[model samples]
Target: MLREKIFYKDELPVSVITANIVDYPFHFHDDMEIVYVLSGSIILKSGYYTYTLKQGDMFILNDRDMHSLERTDEDNMVMMLQMDLSYFERYYPDLRDQFFVVDMEEDKEENLSVLRNIMAEIMMEILQKGQGYEHKVIESTHNLISCLISDFCYVVNEDGKFQNETGGKTSKILAGRLNRIMDYMYENYERKLTLSEIAENEKLSIYYLSHIIKEATGLSFQDLLSYIRVEESERLLLESGKKIGAIAEEMGFSAVRYYIKHFEQWFGMHPLEYRKRYMGKSMTRESRAKYKRCTPMEIETAIHALTRGAFTETEDKLVLKPVIIDIGTAVGDDDNGQPKTAETSAKDPKEAGIFTIMERSVNDILAEPYHLLMDLGETVLAAGENYVITAEGTDTKDISRLSILVYNYDENVGRSLRKIHTENDLLRLVRHYDDEIEFLIRCNGFSGLYRIYRYRMDRENLAKKLTDSLNPEGGAGKRDMLIGRLTGAPTVTTNTYTSSDVLSVRTTFQGMGVELILVDRI
Candidate 1:
């Protein structure tokens, strides 16, 4: 079926993703598609050819090929890259007439290997969101197009066999004509097409059109139309959620029996059987519900792990706020940890309370058919004593930005004495506190050049002096746990790391505070 796909971002002309694919029904669009097996296996049907692909294998679908995907096992993951070739219309108007095909039975591993590597790099750049990664993806997409045209697309003889490069210009002309007809077949397969209809549409005589159709595809007009219609109906069987009779009628078949016969002719099974074999298996309610969008950090980790058994390494400015439990604890003391003055403390209770004047807006309450429940996550442990030394890896929506918010919320008796000890007589400590809290960030999933910006937001300094204070810091090898230590006021700093698998940020947190940390690719 001609299911239109609008799948690009910012006019990039290429849409790519690494997904745990289970099923994709038979459908065709104008874009060329490439499917690479990252892990496990998948059974793909392209046109009349069915292939069971294993890891490290790739298949290209062109000729506006009608294709579908089915998982062979539960753990299958695939990289689907779709390129809108119409983008090249500016440079090469004949792109639509070019028929791209790969002969798996032939010896073409060299070109295929090159394609795999280029695609891997593209995936890395796209997922990593490194500096200039967009440009890199565009450039690599161009390379992929070039490779496809030069290696996979070639003129064939009248029998639909590949002709030699020596065929030259004549081969090009014939190849263009064939691909043109193939494209036409895809665009109009849903209709009751005939030699007369095709001839009328192409502005050519019936005799000439018939000869070329056979010459180009080694199939007569009627045979080609039947093949295409049967191929396209697969989408309806698996995806439309419609009845067989309705699907047959929609696919331009005169009757359900005829549609079933044609389907069996091409795929070696009844349409009902094919649908039963795959429909409930994937793209079901359960599968859709199980699908979860991975965070950018998790995605980077996945891409690296899938491509190699290893690690790798974007930037946007995002400030991370550290974990600040509450400021109400110090209400008895001033910003300098000094007790309130006698005059300030002697005011009437109602007149001197924090919110001496209060305002609340009342709105009409509306009843609804359904009620909603919420989870306000567990804030405190049953015990009164608790420490707050932690490193949280954060992500910014679809961007390749990574951040860590670290803080020292250690409220033990000792640090409370060494640090916020000024108000000892005014406020009493009542929580379990460690001498210092420290956590390790395992960054083995990234590598390469990274510009690390240290954003040190000292909550106490700002509260005490109301000054512009941000402690900037610095890097670590892969898997190294850099403990965060709390200390004096934070200072501004930036460090660039050129090598390392990114095992650790190798950082520290000691005192008390809350803020976010960010890491961008360079």
Candidate 2:
């Protein structure tokens, strides 16, 4: 089959393409793609969702997902770790379950970034072709797959609904064949592809393949091929200075007019406009301007926790209150599997519904930072207009002295601030708005920083404004804020530093003498 050729014989042995990261149309592939973000940020659009990736992030693309890459900011030097699954199978049969094929039934976002830095370095080392390159490559591949499975397999496994559900015969076979066909189309995108050609290659009657293709993907086989061709053509057009007619001809289109029709039909814009909108942003240019390659110093910083005796009982003393916001289909049993109707479970608990929405929003927002806050469990506070702070020790009495405040962002602010675990985390967040507040205050001839702050501190209207300003969409402000606070000098010292520079802060704040108070800051 043409699909088998793409993966088994032709494109699978060794495929390597290192290019600038730019926006491309939706497309699929038969080979496995191992992409490492050398520098900068990228937005990956696949199927119905988009994934935003940062430097030190790498993702595997298989499952023949129709995805594309977009870079909003420059410096996206992405090292693509593409492998023909066939080679993977030959080289390491045991790793088949690890990198065999993306489970088309599941999403690839979760846990894919586990040990990203290590894997990226391995990939970089291979690209550099140092001593024992072959050995290093094999080792790196081993480590990469091991890390992925160990850290992230849980995400795919736990999200049972998204994973392959047991109980499908024809659907599974049809899906698998469709995946095979899509892979073939991507591998031979620049070559001529016809319905009869694919049908014959799949060893299915032309009539059956036609019906199955349409039924499976909701697009005619011919239209799907045209879509794939135009998509690849779009990538080449934007990434290279190829002429429109040349690109059309190269992709097997009958003429430039036919190419234009397909391109316009798929992208809602002409080829030229589409190229202009998506192209011009290159990984080389962006990475050079905004990102510096991981220096030995930064790598050392990431490895600080690994140093012997570098951390002692005195250093892990910070007790942070972490609040888990429950988000999901908690409001009503809307688990994406049922027909919508006026049901009994829908109307009873309005507050519960609100809590569920807030919980979900909070979870989504703090998804990245929760990793750092794993150990510090001071109190699980339910935050809203009223703050409900709870801690398990008899020392909870003094928690009030710490001045705990809950600030909720406004509805229009784009993000929900309800998920932040503690007032200290919020204070660190406030530092990000320092420049913006300073500018607004100075421009308006405000009396003082406090006066300007008072407006933003308004719980109903201004708090959300500040929250939005601090955590803008796709902005790294919150991360910077968290990093700053985490590495900051706290006002009160729970432990004194010794000459050895090792200190531990006792988290006994929630202990016997501790008190808890909830204040509304916004």
Model 2 worst lDDT run, 10 consecutive residues: 437-446
- The lDDT leader among the candidates is 1
Per-residue lDDT tens digits of candidate 1, residues 59-137? 8766456567888756776778888776645433566656665545452566565556567756766776665345446
Candidate 1 overall lDDT versus native: 0.50
lDDT of each candidate versus the true structure? 0.50, 0.42
Per-residue C-alpha lDDT of model 2 across residues 1-522, encoded as one tens digit per residue? 011123222211343444555654454555666665655678875444456777655556654545567776665655555555554454235443432223323333333332443444444444454533443344334444444433333211321112332212111222222456777877886777777888788677888777766644556777888887876675588779999999999998888999999989876789998778668764222222222244444333433422211111111111223222221112344567653322123333224222443344333322212222222454432233322222232132222211222222223221324546543454444333321100000001001101000111222122333354455546557887665444331222121111101001111111111112222111
Give the lowest summed-lDDT range of ten residues in model 1: 363-372
